[model samples]
Target: MFEQIDCPEAQRLVEAGAQLVDVRGPDEFARGALPGAQNIPVQVMAQQAGQLEEHKPVVLYCASGARSTQAQMLLQQLGFPEVYNLGSIQKYYTC
Candidate 1:
């Protein structure tokens, strides 16, 4: 899938108050993630859709790009206006 946002851009977004979501399992997220990110597995995002709001954009990531891509699509389908993929968890390391 086409990338909606790159790691650097995503980092900037995070710094600028954009919402960050770690779409990995809790154990993986507990290991580490971008600061201020919310941990919510992709498999449970649909049921937890209430936790998100459409007006504010959300930047999501996982161990790889795949799960975040799925999350972006699901969020969009759930009517989120702006959903961005921040790529893999590695991106958080250098940012």
Candidate 2:
């Protein structure tokens, strides 16, 4: 598994225009999410990847880093060069 990321680091990437995707379930995301982050749920990442914007830097996140990291790796295996896991949503979702 990948090391966890801090809120500050995640926020910096977001500020730099990373395409943040929330992989948490809909309920969790509905409660809160990083500003501008979209909820796609990790369970659907593989199938829904085509829906992602290819030109942007993709940053995935969940309640914890695990699912996002997994999603990131999956995307990478699928040839997504700009994918990364942004870690815990609680660490960054303030909006």
Candidate 3:
């Protein structure tokens, strides 16, 4: 199972050049997203994932923990190194 990183740790990774991915639908992403995050909706992640650099660290988050968790494992299987799940988007606002 993939471990979820705390918001502070996730923030550090983002600052250090990790790819910030929002795995929610366009509508949700449009409403709000973490700073520097790019929407890559979980439904089409496999196809759109090529946009990301395989060598870069990836930090994923969704409305809830579910979608990001799924995306984290999928990205790992697809050969992306250093995938970090930040769980819910709320954590970013609260932590």
Candidate 4:
């Protein structure tokens, strides 16, 4: 099952070299996003799954929790070992 982690834990994972992916659209991502976050909108996340590092954990977020949660499920279904939902980037920024 995929896990939902809070900002502090997400930050810790990122610090430990986890990949932070913004599952929002290109426009939403272009507006603003967490530093070091890569844009891979949920729609194309499956196709781009191979771009993710196999050894590192992957943290996903979007404008709201919905998209990221879906993305988490997709990653897990694709056999990704460590996939985490960080909810909204806005929430992360506030943390």
The candidate that wins on TM-score is 3
Question: Residue by residue across 1-95, what tens digits does model 3's lDDT show?
Answer: 68888989999999999999999999999999988999999999999999999999999999889999999999999999789999999998877
- Residue 59 lDDT in model 3? 97
In candidate 4, what are the lDDT values of residues 1-95, reduced to their tens digit?
55578999899999999999999999999999899999999999989988998668999999878999999999888888899999888778767
Ranking by TM-score: 3, 4, 1, 2
* Alpha carbon deviation, residue 28, candidate 3 (Å): 0.2
* Structure candidate 3, residue pairs in collision: none
Those runs of model 2 whose alpha carbons end farther than 4 Å from true positions after fitting are 1-5, 93-95
Model 2 residue 91 distance off true place after TM-score fit, in angstroms: 2.4
User: What would the TM-scores of all predictions be?
Assistant: 0.89, 0.82, 0.97, 0.94
lDDT, candidates in the order shown: 0.84, 0.79, 0.94, 0.90
> How high is the lDDT of residue 15 in model 3?
93
Evaluated with lDDT, which candidate comes out highest? 3
Error of 1 at 61 (Å): 0.4
Q: Which runs in model 3 stand beyond 4 Å of their true positions?
A: none
* Tens-place lDDT digits, model 2, residues 1-95: 34555667777777899888988899999998877988888898889888887767787888778889888888888878777676777666453
